[model samples]
Target: MEHRVVYLDCYDGITAPLLLGALFDIGLDLNALKKAMAALSLPAHTITSQKQDAPVSGRSARLALDAPEKAVPWRLADTPALLPPGTLKELVRQPVLSMVKHIAQTTSKLQKLPIEDVSLPDITTLLWLIALTLGLDMLNVDENYVSPLPMATGSRQGPHGWEPLLLPEALEMLIRVEAVWYSTPDNKQVSLEGAAFLSELASFEPVNFSVTQVGYGCVPGKSASDGGQSLRLCLGNLSPSSRRAPQPAPSPVQTTLEQAESETDWVTVLETNIDNMSGELLGGLLDHLLELGALDVSYTPMQMKKNRPATLIRVIAPPELGEQLAMSLLRETTTLGVRFQHMQRLKARREPRTIQTSFGPMLVKVKYLGEQLISASPEYEECARVARERNIPLADVYEVARSEVQTLIIGSRKKT
Candidate 1:
């Protein structure tokens, strides 16, 4: 099916008003948005926007919730009354509450108060949450992929003192969502409203789509800081892409394995070169790194600096665990520095299954490309142990396990 897709380039960070403004610029129905907002029946609010073509060109939104009503502290019970009953509610009701609960839960911990007793500071916050959410779903996009976030490292003088560009609230939410981010020298600050709202709506994955329209969401800045920081949104029709499973080997009693399914997400690669590390010491780290949440680790022999033979240690891990793994590497390996970068990884979906073989039950990894099963490989460690216990060759133990799974697959296919 052809799907509408939006690519959000959060190079500078995002804001709820900026988000909705971009969606509005990209053809979100203004009347429909007004109608959806009206269903809430809260105090009156006005949504306005204007085109800006000065230091920047885009649409900026102004959301004015009524004074007294908008200041009401948010409660969990207020969720049901936040949205009217309809498709929009069905799509976004839980996400809106989930976003609120995340804040409330964090607020509870920070304040040393009970969770039920915590409430968002004001209803304006909740209104913006629902509005930003509705803005996205109301577009009816099938998928939205967010670009890697930029950690604005530069700071400036604040009224209090020197302050970091990204605030504590925004940083906390970024961690909660496990955002894929990279350090930037740029001084753009991300807001909690932006990060929290986008977390529940989009993914950081690869997409192949031809953009139909591009909209910039920014308000013309009264000063330099606010002027150029804008969220770039590209709307497009998604090109269907599928990971096809390789056809399995044919047999007389053919076991049509299920196709392989695949998933894509960001992973961090930690690499460093070492010239004076012992092979024995480096080899011992394979298991050590695995225990430290490394997805995979390996070493490659390479020539570094004229004639020095070095081993390049590479570690692939979840971005969230990258720092921990890097720390472990520095402490354990004879390396001075570790370089890390986040990259999107596409891998076949696989699950563990136990099959009764001649040597009893053995574990195997059942891999799928989608609905089709491509291959079922016996677990190496388990097969090796079973071979030793049964006093049989390892290859023979593997064959027995493979045959067992094949028989099961064939029988199941026949029944179906």
Candidate 2:
């Protein structure tokens, strides 16, 4: 069986409660989730559900702040005293520790406090709750692959970041759903039955993942406010191409003949609107799409109704990968729905080659037929780096790269 990975692009921000709600929406048995949370020995936080109405339709799940009135702090200084004897055995698993690290980081960011300022007890309690959610053996501890929490950004506020206690369990549900979702056939990504439930609930398009493993964590705060508490779920897996079997090399003429034989290539254009996504998450999603064999993907800034800023995501991928890619758009970003259109295209045959540059080697996509080189351009990564380091516009760097490549080939011909 092939293992897939799902990447959650948490750009705008993530809250523990929303994660929990999404989990409940996906099919996590509330009773089981509660039992795992109980083992953590935390405060008496209650979980409740309701019909959520987004711009699209109705959804059923737990509210992040079940009852703001009933809220009480689970302070760090009181952790050890609260834990049941030997229950520590089940509270220190990898899933638990990973959650602790994430929750602590988010809390620190929310409070605008240093990670150094976060109480150790709070971290411990968070970890214990994660263990409780997973029902993992306390003795089965292992190091995690990725670091906990993202590096703190400059924008943050408040004293303590902790808010929701239901996030970890909620994340466990999402992790499980994402794992199973990634395993469905490529066509399922955009099918009415595949992402229908999630899309309707969140009012966003969807994101596709080759999800292999999922790890859960919690963040303090509520979703109503920008940086409130939430759950962080890490969906891990490789890109689609990496999963494919190797193909034998073809001779130059054979490749040309095969290219001629290939019918007009068709692809779908996917578009979605997102209000809460961060710039960082958008970048990650685009990179992921390219890795998944997308021909092109881009985002544009726009003002959504109510005068709030938003982004419009656009992607062009092979027809087969269309569904998964579209779902990924909704799953990873804050988009509720996505529009799709199919179109055919004609392209000159192309080959990928590397060209030496003044800074280093740069990759170029060259379109050609027989001995004629029709067109070529420097890779975007190289151009972007040069533009940033030199404090120049990207277009300027592109012009320079093209000039350099042309000069190199022309000079070589003269020398010959």
Candidate 3:
């Protein structure tokens, strides 16, 4: 059965409690939530959820720090002599690493520090790891699909006093929000894109939504006065798609995965190495390729002449688009030539999905045909935000999401 998951947008960003609140709002069993948490490190903290009126009407869950200042203290933990070859390999499971890195970078903006001096977890890598562990489908994050929030000019006090209001990016990085839009402190209006994303996720009409449970994660931010950062987690469930929505039946059709795999298709793999191009520029080019029908594009870190750091970029696409996309690469970056490969592909298909987790809602993209789900990835935005707030493993959040999504789908089928 096909399914579409709706997500609750945190306009101001997300908090551990807020995630719990959102799940409660949509209807999640508290007993199931406690059972899930009990499997993790315990005697560490307390999670309490209660009805609140301030943020409209919903239940709010708060994580009372057992040891207020207790965090995974970096200074106290083992320091890497050289970042250990695959030490970062663990980051694939830790979203906090990514959040911490993001916080460190954004803090550099607020405090005027160097990027190299900043240190933290690799949140992006961690989200990917967790999603992989849970067997949830992943999506190609279109950073180019940037929707900007309205800017508010003025001064406001943060942890410090009388400072200019931090822009959306700064706050988003600070609080670890997935998708955010700026607005006056007083609720008046919202960004068009932000509003649209929310409306689309919540409407649940032709696409009815059924929630399972919710969880919470904490956001960890480093203040000069404070030693380390924190995060919270939250989870929820939603309906996929309705097979019996009562629509007119179309003409009979038969599609076979085996036949699709047998079709002739030539693909070109483009590769290039340039030391001058910024990661941002390279990323943009990759985005265009995917949008232009390129099958896949990625970068691998490598060393250039004189042992200088560099990246080996690879792009795969149909042979017909080779020339046009090559031109795009040349025009967009400083690379002079792109290496190519001509090869035949078996089959290709991409499906986007949303799952209710103990933390919140996530959209996972899967690739497969027939009855098999070949690959899975959890929605990065959903996993990253909850991981930051809950101070739990991003992998665990992904695990819960993967488990719940399967449960919901299977449960729905049995009911019908």
Best by lDDT: 1
Candidate with better lDDT, 1 vs 3: 1
What's the TM-score of each model vs. the native?
0.56, 0.32, 0.37
For model 1, the stretches where C-alpha displacement exceeds 4 angstroms are 68-70, 81-88, 154-163, 226-228, 242-416
lDDT of each residue in 21-56, candidate 3, tens digit only: 444445555555545444433235555666554324
Ranking by TM-score: 1, 3, 2
Specify the poorest-scoring 10-residue window by lDDT in model 1: 252-261
Q: Return whichever of 1 and 2 wins on lDDT.
A: 1
lDDT of 1 by residue, 84-174 (tens): 4453544466567667766665666667888878766567777778787788888877567788887888688867699788766677766
Model 3 error, position 246 (Å): 22
Please report, as a residue range, the 10-residue window in candidate 3 with the lowest summed lDDT. 135-144
TM-score of model 1 (CA atoms): 0.56
Each prediction's Cα lDDT score? 0.74, 0.48, 0.47
